[model samples]
Target chain A: MDYFFFIDLIQSTVDGLLFGTTYALIGIGFTLIFGVMRKLNLAYGAAALAGTYIGLVVFLMFDAHPALVFLASALGSGLIGLVVYLCCFRFTPSNYPMASLLASVGMLLFIDEVVIHASHGLPYPYPSVFRDAIIELGDVWVRGDLLFVFFMCVVAMAALFWLLYRTPLGLATRAVSQQPRAAQLCGIDVTRVNMMTFGIAGVLGGIAGAMTAAAVGVLSPVIAMGLTVKGLIVVVIGGLGSIPGAIIGGLLVGAAENIFLLLRGVTERDIYVMLLLFIFLTLRPGGLFGSAQTRD
Target chain B: MLEIADIKTSYGKIAALKGVSLDIHDGGLTCLLGPNGAGKTTLIWTIAGILKAQAGSMKIDSEEILGLKPHQIVSKGIVTVPENRLVFPDMSVRDNLIAGAFSRRKEKGGIEGDLEDVLTRFPRLRERSEQMAGTLSGGEQQMLAVGRALMARPKILLMDEPSTGLAPIIVEEIFEIIGGLRDEGRTIFLVEQNAHMALKYADRFYLLEQGRVTFSGEPGAVDHDEVIQRAYLGARKAS
Candidate 1:
């Protein structure tokens, strides 16, 4: 094999790994809420897309710094999450799981349409936080934007793990996740824990949205369907409620898709990814780290 | 001490407790004896704040406690070991015990000490501390539930049918533990269908029939044979 070909392979691997970080961030958002409430916010991807729109609007109108734009966008998405919780989840009868899921699906379409109407079907230019070019390694190069997004994702994951395993709030959240009735009996405010969990997930998703926009340098309504499908695939692949599983699953899906694209082209890439998902669902429904039994 | 007065609770239109009243003094075990569907669990739920009383009041140490959330009631130091021992099945036995003390904001060291004490009291729990609670046997789960409640350091522990579904030997062992808890000066409000064990361990007992308290007195005052017959057959022998 040519030395340059080997370098290209290493570069693509790094690129896949870097892109996988964003997927992991999105997966964590899904897993966080699912872990505690056992409810999937199907609109999660839409929420992130909505956040990107917010950042774009702020950057255009106020000429805000990238950091402020990201914060503003996250706040907007967080509010959307709160609304989703109230409208879609809060009042739905607890026993009606199907109804809740349908409501979330409805929410996804509703938000997507709103974004499309607002943006008038045009792809909006998104502001980048970093101005550096790709760093070269032999024949391989890593984009600065992708590297930053990867670092952000790692930091966010670390923070989430700390919040979940190290703090008192995390303990309370875990208690409610395990046994809502018992948690209530122990005087833990179950509703508050649920709200906070959703909020944190929304914030992470918002950051993910901004970082994704920065990575790609553009935002469009078209990305909603693809991102939503990808996020769902990640959630299923990672197991419904396992954090570590989400991270691993996201990376696996990212790298596997890249390798498939290299070997079989884009048309067959999703086919292989979907096949991987189907295989996991049939053989190891719990994902890699998920417990054998499904939790309610 | 706890006082429940004229509490009325219902499932839709059907009333479970209709203006029922009871009192439990401090530092003694009081058993509520009733047949199936006699509103025993309903009353327990109401007192524990899981079910709201439609009419009437509940007071703990003279503080009005009706309508408080279950956790709020727990913060006031009243904890219930619910029927069926609804332990967190997927969680470890240790996690279940930790969950019992969730209402407290105290020293970790002290909580650990209390955990150790509970483990010592229920050696079976110690043996299975790392095991998932769902894997424990019925008898061991009962012990785990009671042990979990004890970790709360509750001022009043409401236990519902702690001996239900246990073997006779396990039942005796559980009653012995209950007797020990009573001796340790914990205020216990027990709901039991097991008249023999209730009479053996409770300082006072209440008999609820058709959602009304038909009998309340010291165990010795109630004729053992009559109470047993009433509990099982819902009738008294014609003299």
Candidate 2:
């Protein structure tokens, strides 16, 4: 590659990695709900953005700082996630996985429409928390916002790990994920576990949505459909119920999309990513890090 | 003390427990013996609150528990070590033990003491505390299941088919544990297909057949009943 091309490649790769942190957050939300309920929240991305929007309203309403905005958005999204669980999952017959899946898809459209109507379908600039805090390391330049997002993602994952591996609630969640009926026998309130898992996932989604909007510098309903699809792709690639699988899958997607943008232009970048998703589906459906399915 | 009176449990249209009633005296090792499909498991599940009784009453010392959720029953000091030792397969044995005390998580000090007690009771479990439960041997898994239930600090421990798939030697070891628990004053409701072994440990024995209590009396009565002899103990061939 030429000198400028090499520079472009490096820059794109770094940018992709930074943005991948957001994808990791969204993927975590998707995987968490899947792990506990064995059901996908197709509206997860939309829920995240919905949280961001509500947080925006609160931010503008109270003249809040970016941190407050992010927190408000996250908390709001958590509620949205709970609502989604009640509507799309709680009452639906569980024997048919497709029923819940379809319900979530419908939820995606419903929430998107609600946001569009509420916002009057106009694009709004999300508050930038660290956009001006750029870092320079010789020839490599890093955006401060991206670095902040990256830090947040790492911290969130660590907290999640501690909650799952070191606490009673975590134990209950894992037991429910592994065997709902057996967990019930252990005196675990399976419904409570499931509900809490959804709430947790919603918080993750909320963070992801806020960070994503900050990165793009704009928020609109148009992003929801694409995000939901991308989130699904990341979950499938990361192994549907695996936590670390989500992180790895998200980074892989971010890196690949950036490399493709340089090689095949913006129009063709998505096509190649779609191809990568298909390859994983056909060959390694268990995902990059999923444990082998076992029978007892 | 536990009371089951005129409890009817149905599986869709067919009734599995037809107004069957029984009482388990406190601090006794009471055993339920019957052939397959005779609702032995059904009655245990009903008392455990796994299945909602269609009609009738169940109480633990005047606190009605009939139709209560399973977790509620557990919180009320009734824990069921379900059939086949359904230990959390992928979790470590230590984690499984921790999960058993899930309802008592707030009682950290009590949980720690109960866990220590359980581990002491099963030395084999202590040796393999870090191992995944799925990797444990069948007898160990059964031990883990029982140990897990004990972590609940249950006043009433409900065990279903403890000796179903175990070897003869292992069965005796399980009975010894049952005897130990009774000695400790833990109320036990045991469901067993091993009529011969059950007879030896039972303080009060009930013989159920075709969804009703055919015989509710001493082990001596079960030994004399030709139906119980031929059906459960295989003591005599059906003539």
Candidate 3:
């Protein structure tokens, strides 16, 4: 019995290691938005889930493959991200950064309500390619779909890294992020760069949302807030606006939650995750990769 | 040539420039000397279109540009090297120079040629091309700022206090570069507190105090004592 429990723990750990990539993707979207605009986009999690639903509708209408559905979802979410910026961020008085934050929170609720109404508060079986296929490594088994998700995560991260560090567009983004006024003086349109950042982050969120729904094999409107809390935790623990920090933080949170769930139960599992966030906030508020908390 | 008429700029309730007016020639060095809070910086920002003038007209070559955006000003051959060397600190020196030529991004060959010209003029920047702008010393950053502005290939350069907070040797070096720019047939509108150094190079001088122009004259005929007195200390004492 004890040996069986140990195996269960190891399996759950492996499962979390794969699932952590989804969390990292979600957190990266949040971090990129924060990095460029210096504002928290609270609606990102809800937007991601909404994107997944849009993908489902596209699949139903066209009988498209899962890959195409995923693509559609990402593109749709990118559009939504731009819309959110236009409605919530663009026209808000520049003097009040808090206004954008509060507005985004309102957007989060607005998106959530829309999703709830459209779905009638129901949970549906989501598409999961290669769901039953498994890999056996001695005494352990790995889900094939999870392995695919991990592979996708690596590809997306690499593409993002190239886009951010290697291209002139990335340079423009960095310039806008650091000194918007100086960038404007340099003849770079600051507003355009901001819009680009939001679009990129939105696509990333859509990917994360679709992948998460596939991994869980079900989609529920209720998980929007939970995913949001998880993403916020990842961003805080990873250090705000730090890409590598988000990745590491997501993995850490996923592993800790899995371990906690194994040791305790479902009711107490979230307590440990919250405790970890509190500990990081108290001990190292700058996060593992952040230098300091300077609100832009 | 740049011309301003009745330019009134304010911050909230307090007016920084109260109907201030000035003219800059096409190929001469013009210096604006003023005490702190006398709105010299405000004047520079207003001309650069960073601050909007409430009731005024600014013309560059007969084109009205009072309400135009900053980038538009740059496009129309007016560029400003701001105070405190406001270069992108994290960007490489080369990048800082490249950004200066951003308005001319469409003119690839011209930008490349101007870059080479700027590099030849400021060899120190060439040496530190890959270094971050923030990592450079105060004097180097100031030089980078000037070089960056030249990348725009401006017809008239508006420089605000290029010599602030620098050693005497560095100040001399900066002034020499400013003199070089003037000799290159570029119009320069310089704002400075160091009247002694400026009078040697400036063709025309304007002294501002309390958001108004107190004095404007040629270098040789101006009363130096009165100018210095107003510069270091505020208010001309009920005269």
Candidate 4:
């Protein structure tokens, strides 16, 4: 019994870590937009869901390849991101952060309603690239789809790092993030940079959405709100604007969630996750890697 | 040459610059001396397109440039070294300098050459190139701010209180740099509370009081002590 319990713990941890990559990808999308604009985009998950829904339509109608679906999802979501910036963030008075937050929440509900109406509030089958493929490591089993998600997440992060460090647009984005007024004096166009940031976040979200749907082998409107809540929890636990923090936060949340599921049950899992968030908030409000003083 | 005629700027209901007029001539340093709240920074921001002027005409060599954006103004070769040395603290000194050339990002070769030249001009910054700007001392930060503006290749440099909050020796070093820029035939519009250092380098000087230009003349034409006193105190007391 003791040996079996240890094996179960290890297996759960491995599974959680792999699944956490999806959460990290989603968390990164949130962090990137927040880093640049210093505003929460509550509609981020819904936007991703919208892209996933589009990908589902393409797959259903044309019998598209998995790669084509992911591509379509990214492009569709990227366009929606720009639209969200224009509608929810762009024209709002910059000083009024609450207005933008509320606007994004409104967008979130609108997108959820749209998706529900389009699909008749029903879940759709999402094709998995690595369907039924699992690797056996002694007593533990690893899903090939989850491993693929992990690999894709690493590739995405590496690409993100390269874009942020080696490109002019990335430099401008960092500059604007650090000191917006100074960036303006440096002749960096703040509005253009902000719009581009939103688009990038959207692309990331779409990929994450597609990956999550494939992992679950289903896509539904309910996933939109669930992902948003999970994404926010990851952001808060990691640190508001720290990229690395979001990744770690996602993994930590994932592992803790699985452990709680084993100790308690499915119904009581989120209770422990919320408890963990509260502990982090009370003891280390800046999160695992954030400075105490954040941009107000 | 830059011309400012009847430029009026306000902060909400409070007007900071009321019908302010001045001429910033080519290839010479024109200094504006004023007490606190005399609209010196306001004028600089307005000229740099960071602030809007309710009523005025700002012309650069006969082209109207009053309503242009800040980056547009920068591309026009008007760069500003803002007050309080606002550097991007989280970025390295080198990155800060590179960001200064954002307006001319397409000119790769020119940017590289300019970056080398700026580093050479401030060796201290070169030594701390990889260090974050926030970690630098106040004096070093001031140097970084000036170097940042220089990277923009400005035809007209608008400097606002470059000497504020620095050691006396550092202030002298900063003035020397400013004086060096003036000698290099750069058109400079300087707003300063340090009238003494400003007078040492200014070809012409203006005294601004309560949002208006109250006095304008060559530095040599005025008594240095009286002008310094008037700069610290309002013109009403000096009169």
Candidate 5:
């Protein structure tokens, strides 16, 4: 009822919206891979974390520019993504979908442990141009790093959309996603297309990882677990394989989390978010934009 | 010419195609007529490299191709129009046709020219080129599937039950298209349950039952009713 509370709510929503860009990027990656593979890569967050760590390594060793660090992260994550595809998805027979699913979960833990061991369980400062800067817009203040992340996410998503809708490679990827057999008959190598999908998703994950780390100004293994949870929540809330659904879901979850944090404090915040997920699952399992097809 | 010899394929332990051998002559419309579960679709899939044969040889002009992947087989200029018209449902008709040219992506001019050719061949597709493939009528989807396969510039086209689930009038139209393709000197292997229609355009016919070829010869060598009866009912026991 207080005027200050209304202003706080608006500011929190703005903050959440900007922060949600990281989740949106991660969600887009998940949806892209799921769209092609029809299987969840549970290692996605850990893979992104590994990429961020690589970026931090480059920063420490070469004292690279922030742009170089981001590029390194994307490349490192893309390589790891190919490896994950070979181990977790490629050799496994598709008829046994659970095999790939469990393999990815195993990969998640394996990569997390590797990062923890390498970093000695310590948090590193991630380089960013606007780590401590802020901008004032009317009565609300927006973090400069969050704004930067939002800008980069928008650019990346635009590029991704162009790749999917306009390029020949995009056509093949979409064809494989829609009907793999038909695509194969059209002379598409299904395995090659799938590997490319994972690589692209990995690249997106890397950027999301760097953006999140830069926004927080810290890189730690602990971030990976939370990110994995948040990414899955975003995917489910948005739609399993829908790109637009992922972006909208990410923003919704972000805004919801901030409001819940304001209303119920940090401890109780996630409970309400989980409750929202539950409501979606029960009432609209297809998600915001998912088709009515059953996942299994 | 495509030669398949002693090809065996299985679904887990159950065999779908067992030691099947057949030859598709150059510039001929060869139709495989069979009843439900007669392994007609299985043979089409096997030839397309969608299903791997456990043993045997498939040769395109004496070059063994049995172990090759689907895309590799497609590069050899064999394209398939799968049953149920498996066009990319969410994509526009133009995109679907473009996707068919995926193997030949490096040939920009050929693709553009082929796009024009396919659109001209199927004008209904041109009218709805921007429409989502899933929204097209069943006959249109079949036409799209055929056109999509054609976009690959296939030397040999394999069509599986293109008439399945289409209206009666639509089936005749599709056969007319098949006849047109035959007249153009394109080699075709069609798997169909519509024996009467297939027989009309088929230069050669193979009747398959339970994964083996029960009968095969030029269409003029057999009675139309006899081939239709043999397709539905199993070969009348040696009597």
Candidate 6:
């Protein structure tokens, strides 16, 4: 390849890596919930979109600081997560995974429609925490917002790891994820652990939403469908319950889709990513790091 | 001490335990012997708080615990090593043992010490502490299950069929362990299909038939051969 083309490819790779960080955050959220409850929250993407709207509302109402806007949006999404748990998951039969899956899908549409009704199907300006400045790294230029998102993603994952491994609550959550009955016998309060997991996952999704909106500088109901698809793909490719798997899978998918766009075009990007997911499922159903114990 | 009075539990419409009552004194190995489908496991489940009793009362040291959740019963120092050696298959042996002490929050240092003590008692667990509980052999898994229960530092340990699917030597080893536990003045309530083992290890035994206690007494008072014949082969004859 020509030197100029080689440099462009390297820059594209950098771009993919930057965008992949957000995908990794979303995948972590999905995997965290699925690992414990063994159920998919189809509304996860919509929950993120709803969080963006919450950020917009905060910005418009109080002209709040960017940090406050992010915090308010995250809290709003966490509340929505609790509602989803109480309305969809709490009463559903424990053994019926499909029932919960369907309920989550219903929730996804409900939230999406509500957003559409409120915003009138128009894309609203989402206040950017990071101004759209370009950072020069040698020959390549990187967006400041994308770099900020990458930093936030790292912070979120670190916090999550600390919550999961360093604290008593994390120990109880892991116990419940591995063996709910045994956890209960140990007096871990399984339901509370589950609800907390949901809330935390929702907060992660909310952060992803805020980051995405900040990166693009706009929010729309249309983002829900695409984000939902991307999140699901990332979770499956990462393995359902493996935290590290989600991060690795997210980066792989992000880079792969970008490479596909570079080689072919935007139209075939998702098809190649979906095909990669199919291949992973066929060869190693456990994702990269998921153990056989996750099978049921 | 434990008292189970007139407990009735059902699955849908079919009753598993029907007005079953029994009293176990403190500091003895009491075995419950019955045939398959004789509601022995049902009684164990109810007492462990896995299944709610429709009508009954269960007391641990005179505290009523019939309607409490499983963890609550565990907090009250009544723990069960459930049938099939349900030792949290995915977790490591050490993790499983640590989970046994989950109900107790105080005495972190003491709990760690107790874990060490259990490892010494069941050396096999010490050798395979990092191994997943599911990968251990049947006999080893049984040892881990018992060791996990012991880690709870429970006042009363309820074991259901710990000897099932083990070899003859392993069964004898398990009985020896139970014997040692009794010698230490720990209370154990065992449910077993092996009449011979029950007679050998249990201080008092209850013969259950279809959810009701048909016989209860010291091992020496009952005819050992007759109980075995009836328990294993359903041989009911005139007195």
Highest DockQ model number: 5
**Which of 5 and 6 is ahead in DockQ?**
5
Predictions in order: chain A TM-score: 0.94, 0.95, 0.95, 0.97, 0.97, 0.95
- What is the Å distance of residue B184 in model 3 from its true position? 1.7
- List TM-score per model, in order: 0.89, 0.94, 0.93, 0.97, 0.98, 0.92
In candidate 1, stretches whose alpha carbon ends up further than 4 angstroms from where it belongs are: A1-10, A129-140, A290-296, B89-95, B106-141, B165-167, B233-239
Rank the candidate models, highest TM-score first. 5, 4, 2, 3, 6, 1
* Candidate 5 clashes between residue pairs 3 or more apart in a chain or in different chains: none
Task: Write the residue-wise lDDT of candidate 4 on A1-296 in tens digits.
Answer: 69999999998889888888778888988998998888999999999899888899999999999889888888788888898999999999988999999999999999999999999999999877786888999999998998887887778888889999999999999988888888989999899999999999898888888888888889887899878988988988899888999999989888888888988999999999999989988998888888734441
TM-score for chain A as predicted in candidate 3: 0.95
- Give one digit per residue, the lDDT tens place, for model 3 in A1-296: 68888888888899888889889988999998887788888988888888888887887788888899889878888888998999888899767989999999999999999999998999877778888899998677999999887777778888898998776667778777767666666667777888899899888888888888888778788988987999999989999888999999888888888889888989999999999999999999889998744422
The candidate with the higher lDDT, 2 or 4, is: 4
User: On a 0 to 1 TM-score scale, where does candidate 5 land against the true structure?
Assistant: 0.98
What clash count does candidate 4 reach?
0
- In model 2, pairs of residues that clash are none
RMSD in Å for all candidates: 3.1, 2.3, 2.5, 1.5, 1.4, 2.4
User: lDDT tens string, model 4, B79-179?
Assistant: 99989988999899999999999998998488989989999999999999999999999999999999999999998999999999999999999999999
lDDT at position A156, candidate 1? 82
**For candidate 1, what's the TM-score of chain A, rounded to 2 decimals?**
0.94
Per-residue lDDT value at B128 in model 6:
97
Off by over 4 Å in 2: A2-4, A291-296, B224-239
Question: Which stretches of model 6 miss by more than 4 angstroms?
Answer: A130-137, A281-286, A290-296, B106-109, B235-239
DockQ of each: 0.56, 0.68, 0.51, 0.73, 0.77, 0.52
Off by over 4 Å in 5: A292-296
